[model samples]
Target: MNGQVMKKLLKIAVVAAFSFQSAIVSAKLEMIDRVVALVDSDVVLASELVRRTNSVLQQIKSRNQTAPPLDKLQAQILDRLILESLQMQMAKRVGVRVSDTELDSAITRIAEQNNLSIEQFRKSIEEEGTSWAIFREDIRAEIMVSRARGGSVSRRIKISDKEVDNLLVQIDNEGLSRVQYSLGHILLPLPEGASPEEITKIRDKADKLIRELRNGANFQEYAITYSAGQNALNGGNLGWRNASQLPTLFSGSVKNMKVGDISEPLRSGSGLHILHLIDSKGGFETHSVIQTHVRHILISPNAITDEKAAFDKLKLIRQRIVDGEKFEDLAIEFSDDKGSGSLGGDLKWSDPGTFVPEFTKAMEALAVNEMSEPVKTEFGWHLIEVLGRRNQDQTEEKKRERAYRILHNRKFEEEAQIWLQELKEQAYIKIIDEN
Candidate 1:
């Protein structure tokens, strides 16, 4: 494989390792004896499952106002473990591999996402009782599986003009509900106590980048390599995002652009920005009030030892709301969820199946402006309030277009899975069980 592909694969493997850490275990007689489950070429250990279980539980406790029963959690863990084994087998059959560079880049991306330096991110993981080596291996495996899937399935999928036309017709008939847009952005960041020369340099850089893009130097590549933003790794994808999802400064520019157009660089408080329109659909003249928001919360379990302690803390907060205190105020004061709690735990309007089951259940249970009791999920205790709900009557055209896209994805996955299974059946796999 090419170096780039190898790098990507390695990074993916690290992610996989982190994802499946709970399924592998090492022996520690002083602590607990490690047990092996199904051992393929990739070993599944009891310690790995335990680690994963704890990580999942921690996540659940963070967002949920309540916890799921242990039996349910165990089943979920086993399902994940089985899926991992299948993917790993597929990777071996396909001869998918990851390189060290890819692993480093993936780690870098993770660090950036957490707003941490690479060293700091590593330290954090290490502190959580995980070995970085194991993490990297997991990520590498994931990368291999992804490459295998893409190589096997993407080559066969074609986007035809007829398909596009049909999709458009359906969208037109249905009255497009979710607007998709193509956007390009140039950011101009201000320096502290910047002189004229510094500001000029910043603008000059943006201008140069714009010139290159206009001249047909791939914008996505430039964004990936040069953009000093979180979305850089995604090649500035921004992905079918809503206008309201953008910053106020860029949203207006995005709203005005047609497909395949570029915007003039505009200055914002943080920096200067230039946007290019890739494509857009739906939201022709109006938008539905409801938007689906998906969120994940991380809770530190150092404070609360048992489920009761966690539940009790959340329950107390709920009691305060029953006593007539504002939900937002309670969220700000007591909720351990930092991301949404600051906003009074408002997830904004979202579509169905957008949130974790527990969070969705709470939201669905509440009427408009109605507050829910402390509900527990894996995240932790949650008190949800439904802000509002709206059901837009979609046209037949929209339905067909949506159906086609969904079907295409489903088919791709199905084909990819079959291909991987065949590859696995042909490959040489050896299992070394140490436990």
Candidate 2:
């Protein structure tokens, strides 16, 4: 009888231990893998969403703010992942890729921006508990996505000379200086697949909130309490935005409103929005522009001349120019910028923002008659010489350039919206876990 009781106890203990081990193993496997979302043929894994969410959570903590509920945050992150997956798929189909060399160069540029060397950047990421390899891959993916978006959007943007002229006239009518708005926003979200009654309720709620705001309620406090936007916790502040940069829905409304004015409830597909103007500045700022007259010998790398070779060649050319070689002769003989090379590399007088940021910055740093060290721009490696500087009255050329830029920006925003919506509507996106 004693032996039998002891055997029964031993059997029970073994069974319990095995069951516990199995559960531990099951949890570990589940934690590491699962499909969170599906974008057409591709899926966003649970692990990927969690990793990205953790990064955002860290940012929130560093800002000393309370994070939203994990499920809510995860759902939002999952949506982003779905979009990224779609874009990446498109990128793959279009044969868009960021090469290893490009990735390395981009990483190095980022490191330089952060005042660190590439190795130091790796150490910094490791110190922050992120893998360097993973970081590099993340950057490469970002570049791919950016390139993909550009490819999709650029083809759709069309600005004619007539459109540019019309934009310039509109700007001149509005006065050269325009008001930049700092806005406080409140969004009453319209749920996905919301019924007409539900939409009416949200819009009515927005109207009530707007009335309350007009009746002397604090806008920031109201935004925090009532807004369903991403910035609700931060009081729905849109920060300062030029009219051109404002959301298409808000821009027209904001343009007419004065500082400290509250807008009527504006309806959009996503939700009802109420905006309070916080402040206004600039657009009233005069264009006391300092113009620079500069010229450069540009050399773009081809299959025959790689980036390193182009850079080295420019460096030698710069040395020759410094050692009493005539810049115009060298530019005519060797520069690849056919238009400027034939003109002895003379770009002529240009106001600020006329050129790309890299070219502008390097040119600005050089004194009149001083030659820049081989500087790299989107076009290519450049050896710039600032011929002169002056304070000039705004010219038609400058006005036209500005108008083209403004029109391009406005049209780009409008087109981007239409394009992105079309992409999303056509894509097959399925959420594995809705909650």
Q: Cα deviation of 219 in candidate 1 (Å)?
A: 40
* Model 2: lDDT of residue 283: 61
**TM-score of candidate 2 versus the correct structure, residues matched by position:** 0.61
Query: Native-vs-model 1 lDDT?
Result: 0.61
Give me the runs in candidate 2 sitting further than 4 Å from their true place: 1-30, 112-121, 160-162, 176-178, 183-239, 256-263, 268-279, 283-395
Question: How well does candidate 1 match the true structure, expressed as C-alpha RMSD?
Answer: 24.0
Give a tens-digit lDDT track for model 2, residues 25-116.
77532222556666776767676888888886776677665666676666666766777777887887899989899999999999999999
Q: Where's the lowest-lDDT run of ten residues in candidate 1? A: 292-301
Q: Which numbered prediction scores highest in TM-score against the true structure? A: 2
User: Candidate 1 at residue 71, lDDT?
Assistant: 52
Estimate every model's Cα lDDT from 0 to 1. Answer: 0.61, 0.78
